[model samples]
Target: AHIITAVIGSGVLSLAWAIAQLGWAAGPAIMLLFALVIYYTSTLLAECYRSGDPETGKRHYTYMDAVRSYLPGTKVKLCGVIQYANLVGVAIGYTIAASISMRAVRRADCFHYHDVRGRSGKDSCKSSSNPYMIVFGVVQILFSQIPDFDQIWWLSIVAAVMSFTYSTIGLGLGIAQTVANGGIQGSLTGLSVGPGVTSMQKVWRSLQAFGNIAFAYSYSIILIEIQDTVKAPPPSEAKVMKKATGISVATTTVFYMLCGCMGYAAFGDAAPDNLLTGFGFYEPFWLLDVAN
Candidate 1:
């Protein structure tokens, strides 16, 4: 549950756009490659949980501690700096995404009501997302005040459940949209270079897609902390961590593939930057709102 909570994030929403840039062939391949790489690295990190013995050894309580154990000296400091920096960036990105999703929910409802009233809603729906961002910030601050926030057992479970909820909704909606479009709607080579998109743009977007997919799979930074939460092992901590990592990676990859591929099939090169909030699957506005 902790692994799932850490691995499956808002970044999953951008996967359709990432796949669109890479096209049918390379997109899925790259996603699988990333999954393999992450799983292998996670297994290796699991082995590093204890210095000498697998069952009885000094425990590394955090990722930085693990680094200090294996790779001492200046490298540990550098690793700490980089890891925290990445985490800070991730926090900011998630906050922005949350705010946007909240705004999308309101906009979906607004459009619904306006259409019912026979009035143009597009003109009045324009509003800053600052208020939503502030609300998210305040909620996060409250959560941060909780002692040993990571060890709150129920927290990860709830997060994992919510992640699966929206992910499944996204996959279902993607399938529905694909069926409504009368067939699959993408190419083996992805977006073509021509009128609107130049060769340079395609190259950049493809490279961006690589980063997007990588970001979606990112969770190694918190692996050690998560592993610390597991009870002392009879089967061995490394073994248990490996098993958990595999399950989490497989589950998330299945959802990612379904959501990303089906969304691409539905919208082809025109896939939105976000599957739920990008206005691609607008009607069934209520469902979209719920997913967001």
Candidate 2:
């Protein structure tokens, strides 16, 4: 559950759009490569948890603790600063993503009502993401106040369920839409070779896709913290951590492929940054958009 909460989040939603940018072949390949890299790094982090002969007393409970134990001088402080800064950035990013999702839901609801009333000018129901971001940020701040890890078990469970729920909805809608539409959009070419003007531009765009995949697979910063929660002996925690990481990565990879491939197949070049928002006011899809 902890691994699931750590790995699968709003990031999954943009994967299809990322794939669209990278084309079909390179996108899945890059994401799978990221999964491998994440797994490797996670094992390295697990190994860092213990020192000496593994049966010895040394054990680091947090990322900074691990850094301080392993590194010397200013390097420890630098790692600490970078780690916390990354966490802050992640928090802000998630809040902004939640606001975007909320805005998509709002737009879908407005369009649905407009269509039902048979009266539509421009979408008069104007709103900004600021209020939604504030609401999400407040909720996160409240959740952050829970000092005990054990006390947050329910929160982790809830988050894992929500992640699975929305992912399933998004994938189902994509597949359904693809079938109903009877074919894919844009180029059926295997590799999105060059949607850009110049070859150099295409190469740079592909590199950007690689970066997106890397960012999506990054949970290394929290691997130590999650492993610390396992109720096992020092030496055995590595095994526990490996098993948990394997399962989580495997599960998330399947969802990512399904959502990315099906979404790209359905929408192709038209895929939006948020796949749910790209759906517009389409029938039953509006519900999926809202749920996602």
Candidate 3:
């Protein structure tokens, strides 16, 4: 549950756009490469949960603890700064993503409601994300206040379920849209040097795509913390964590492939940066709202 909740984040929503940037050949290849790399590194990090032994040695309660245990002085501080900075960036990104989804839901309803009333373009349905961001912030604060959140067994489970819910919805919608398009879209080389995109822009976007795929598979920063929650000895915390990491990475990789490929097939080169909230499929507003 912890692995699932951590692995499948808002980063998955960008995969289609990433794929579009990299093209048919390089996209899936890079994704699989990232999956392999992440899984391997995660296992290594999982093994680092304990200082000297797999089963009995002193436990490193946190990532910083593990760093301090092995790489003594300055490296620990550097790791701490990098790790927390990444967390802060992730928080901001998620907040923005939540606000975008909220705005999308409202805009979807606005478009639908107007269409039903025989109105077209009368209202652009644009709205500020400030209120929505504030709402998400409040909700996050409430959740954070829960005592011993990491030990709350059901919290990760609920989060895992919600993550799967929206992910599956996005995948289903992508598949449906692809079928509706009558044929497969996209090329082996992806977006060509056309009128809108320059050669330099292609290079930049391709590099960004690598980062996007990497971001989707990144859960290593929390691997030690998750490992700390495992029950003792018999199987060993390292063993359990490795198993969990493998399963989670494999599961997420499958979902990422399906979502990314189907979305790219559905929208071709013009795939939006976000599959669900990017107005890729405006119809079935209720479903869009639910997914968001």
Candidate 4:
């Protein structure tokens, strides 16, 4: 559950745009490659949990501890600072995504009501995403007050379920859109590029897509922290961590493929950065946007 909570997030929503940037063939391949790489790195980190005899002394409870045990002098502090900074960046990114999603949902709801009433409702809500981001940040601050990792097991479980819920909804909507459109928007080869994009620009866009895929798959900074929460016999935490990593990665990969492939099939080069936003304020989509 912890692994799932860490691995799946708002990043999955933009995967279609990433794939659109890379094309169909390269997009899914890159995502699968990222999954494999992350799995390998997670197992490597799991192995670092215990440095000596498991029944004896000295286990690395956190990522910085592992770095400290292996590195010298200021390098240990440097690693700690870097890891925390990466985590903070991840947190900020997610918060911004949540705010954007909330804004989308609100717009969708307003549009839906406008459609039902046969009138425009654009001026109903004048709020921007910053307010929602601030609210989410405050909520995160409250959650952060929980000092113990183990104490948040239930929260992790809830987050995992929510992740699955929204992902399933996205996959289902993608399938529906594909069927309604009678086929994919682009050719089967999926090699199309956005309008006015030059050949050189294509290369840069593909590289950006690669970086986005890498960023989406990155959860190594938290692997050791999650592993530390496992209750197992000495040295067996690696086994538990391996199991969690496999399950989370496998499940998330399926969802990623569905979102990327089906989303591109539906929108082609016009795919938005947030897949859900492209659907607009339609029935059921508004609900899905709310759920997301």
Candidate 5:
């Protein structure tokens, strides 16, 4: 939940854009994928809980702890390396993906500020200004300045490597779910609700989504089933689990909404587009730059 949500909420700002790319027909399938992902995430989180609170001495089924508990050997060195590689790949991929969107926003803003002026209004860049979009802006500048020969060579190499990585089943499943199923507009659109748009409708959708993951509503049983097989916590633990689960998800969702809104509002499109120069993110803000 944390990783997938973090990446989509923080990494891929344009959850709306990605879902649109998948098409409306993709909704049910995408949702199935989300269910699977939730199961997987819950499995992981249940493990997190098994490991007694981080403050305490006892341990639960955390990935590393699980591995250490079950697979102790000289090959532990191998496990450590594999972990590092996984993290590095995540960082690089997130940086690259987010950077692309940032670059797009920057390009759009540059056009607005210099070519067309900031009259885009509703036609402004997409919402969901994730961190991936921000770094892409920087990539745009670097791509332009680097020597054409070596740069072209490296770009091809990177593309090929990334493709191979995604060829792995795990990567494909994880990426596909996050890109298409990560809800942005779904929390708003195509949802069942009372007729006409109303604040109450908005609140209902948000709560529906909250139930989908948190609150242990319809999803609780299936998720808790996976949890049982993994962590096997006592029934007495339900109260603590519920509290922790709610806090984690609520914080993440709020962070996402705020990140999306302020990022688009302040950096607007350029926040994603100008990531490469990183500085160009503010180029469209000539007035603010001067004021500062």
Candidate 6:
């Protein structure tokens, strides 16, 4: 769910988008950073998972619960904060897609619009913007539940994730739709940066942009997860789980860096906005049709 939000708001290749604004030499550096962030995120998660809390006989003492306890507030206030943040996050979801769309349309010189008009006729899913998410998140969430077993807690998390997403729209869109739309209007607002930046320049920027967004998204996600765990406390085996989370982050970082490097190597001077898929030519092991 969070990754979906990141993709919509920042657009893929946000690392490349930012780097293209720099120059060609940024290729190696951006990849390195992506790897590092992945490391921190994964590491912290593992630590949280491994370093289990010796079960203080408290139900609300998960990872997230601990952090909030220090604030000296009522439980009601804490829950309110979480709800508020998510509401604001909903706006972010729409704004991200809007920003990327605006930029893409402008970059095409207003020639290749091809807006994604959903049944509502407001937005389209032409670029897997919402389809991949809807399918994976919604469909998978449903499929994950076969017999709707005799478990109570298990059923709740599934419901939480499902409840979070709203048909790919903004939170206060009706009221702040104008502001949200304006935030991304800069995609085509500024004067031309130059007389057509090189394709490599574009590719480099695309990779850079992606790396940056992924780094932020991954990092933020981890931090948030850890905080939640620490505050709220995980199950009895939470400590053991921390180690696994840490290992996953470590592995994820290395994989992300490799993905970036391979991307640069393959795209060299002709990388597209979504270069991760394009970079697959150099990575025979990557078995997905992300480029499609």
User: In angstroms, how far off is 140's CA in candidate 5?
Assistant: 19
The digit string of per-residue lDDT tens for model 1 on 1-292 reads 9999999998888899999999999999999999999999999999988889999989998898889988879999999899999999999999999999999998888888888888874778867889999999999999899888866789889999999889888888889989988999899989999999999999999999999999999999899888988889797789999999999999999989988999899899999999888888768888878888
Which residue pairs show collisions in model 4?
Answer: none
Alpha-carbon deviation at 257 in model 6, angstroms: 2.0
For model 4, the superposed segments whose C-alpha errors exceed 4 Å read 54-57, 121-127, 146-150, 187-195, 278-281
The backbone clash count of each candidate, in order, is 0, 0, 0, 0, 25, 53
TM-score pick, better of 2 and 6: 2
Instruction: Give the least accurate 10-residue stretch of model 1, judged by summed lDDT.
Output: 119-128
**Candidate 2, superposed: residue stretches over 4 Å from native:** 147-150, 186-204
Stronger candidate by TM-score (1 vs 2): 1
lDDT of 5 by residue, 182-224 (tens): 4323321333345565667556544443332322112322333
Better of 1 and 5 by lDDT: 1
Q: Which residue pairs in candidate 1 have backbone atoms (N, alpha carbon, C) closer than 3 angstroms, thus clashing?
A: none
lDDT agreement of model 1 with the native: 0.91
Superposed by TM-score, candidate 6 places the C-alpha of residue 127 at a distance from the truth, in angstroms, of 9.6
lDDT of 6 by residue, 1-292 (tens): 2222222222323333333333345444554555566555545443343233445443332435544544456764776577567646654554444444433433332222333222342234224344444444565457668674422434544432432222111121211323433432212111123567666655565655654545433433333333333443444434544454455444433433333333333333333444322221222111112122
Q: Scored by CA lDDT, what does every candidate get?
A: 0.91, 0.77, 0.91, 0.78, 0.39, 0.38
User: Which sections of candidate 6 miss by over 4 Å?
Assistant: 1-27, 34-64, 74-194, 197-211, 214-242, 276-292
Quote the lDDT for 64 in model 5.
55
Candidate 6 — worst ten consecutive residues by lDDT sum?
A: 166-175
TM-score versus the correct structure, for each prediction: 0.98, 0.90, 0.97, 0.91, 0.37, 0.41
